[model samples]
Target: MEFDTPVLDNHLHLDPENGRGMEAVQDFARSGGTHLLVVNKPSWTLGIDVDEPADFRAAFETTIDIVDEASELLGGRAWPVLGVHPGLVSHLTERGFTPDEAGELMQAGLDIATEYVPSEALALKSGRPHYDISADVWDASNRVLQHALALGAENDCAVQLHTEASEDLTEIADWATERDLPAHRVVKHYAGGRLVGPMPSVMSEKDRLAEAAERGEPFLMETDFIDDPERPGAVLGPKTVPRRVRWLLDEGFDDAVRTAHVETPRRVYGIETLG
Candidate 1:
């Protein structure tokens, strides 16, 4: 199948060491995907025990390299979004670091990630844990999230957030506002439906895509394909966005498909020629 407009997967991972890697990207391209925002996996997933901030460099570099290689193979573009995953907080605490210490380490890691923005990386990823946690740990996570927001503001790049499911993102929008990051640039990854605040990278589900289109709101589409060989098709597959967009186009949702797959991503990520 071919798409008239670029098909972008806003959040995807390619693990060359442990998963199908570029082969999964091939699946997306064969399904008509054009662009992607390849996000970095958690440090531990890359076998890096984050005892220090610089330890994140390997993971970030790997993501950059993947983006470079994927872009060469892709019909369109592939930009890297590097950062410290919010789950790193739990990992750090479990490794014997206190909540505050964990937060500090995460913030430092994000600081390193920012150095790559607008050049090696196109955006930064950060958020609090979606699952339950102690208040102290939650607070620490919030601090780290705020730090990421600040970095996004400073770097003039988008920030992809992975947080608990919520119908509204007013609170997070406020955080972006305080940091001077455009609310629209603060994307809520894995979003289920139309949200109240912050731009949503809606998961590529048929019903949800139709709902967002019907509302005529600007949004982006994503698969969040983890590419883990151990759990194939976890979250969603690499070809999901293109497949869903093809269906929406067949259903006469052309305008929505254009806005979600092209316009929204171009505006938010500052890519002038995405489609």
Candidate 2:
């Protein structure tokens, strides 16, 4: 299982506040992973106060700080992917902000995140799934995502999105299309076989890999590792993608291995092909 290009784990959450965060990364690295692209979030706020506006504000700041901590932990071997996760918007509503107000706050946070684009961020990850949120709130989240896309457009950065895995990512692709963003710059995170745009973080399904390999454009891969000990390896582990991808490569899909594991990640997340 030799990779001609860097074997990058394109998406995972590493809790910079906890020691296990880097441990998870180190384990993956020891398993032949070259680098990782970590998305920053304060999931520790899970048991904390989401009902208090002040508490939520503090948690939000902590989320921002975690991105910095991650940059240091991976020692430039990893890059930070920052954005207002869709759950954060819903959480704001729980804290008493209206959907519109939460959208506004999401936009403001995205603006602040954009300032990190040239300094600390590798990319922006807008849109985290919102099945529990109301339709109006979901629409509001889309509005915030629009801001994030625009920010990426302005800064020449890439954006990986969180959304429903459905018939296709038509609506999201349309947003990027309407704004004239390059197709390669938009990533559909947590994606399945059906792709609507470039660089989907395709899940650990072999059929999905076969499907994506047939497509002309290269797709990215991810385990979407939540890294919570309470439900460890809920979706998949950090080593899953690299291990499975290695299998695909051994099965004679060197091209898919190169495209998904190498080119797509570099194009979408801006990581070099090697550490």
lDDT for each residue of candidate 2 in 102-183, tens digit (9 for 90 to 100): 7887777677677667677778778755477788897898898887788888888898888766647666777776877776
Each candidate: how many clashes? 0, 1
Over 4 Å off, model 2: 1-4, 42-76
What's model 1's lDDT at 236?
Answer: 92
lDDT of 1 by residue, 84-135 (tens): 8999999999989999999999999999999998878999999999999999
Residue 8 miss distance in model 2 (angstroms): 0.7
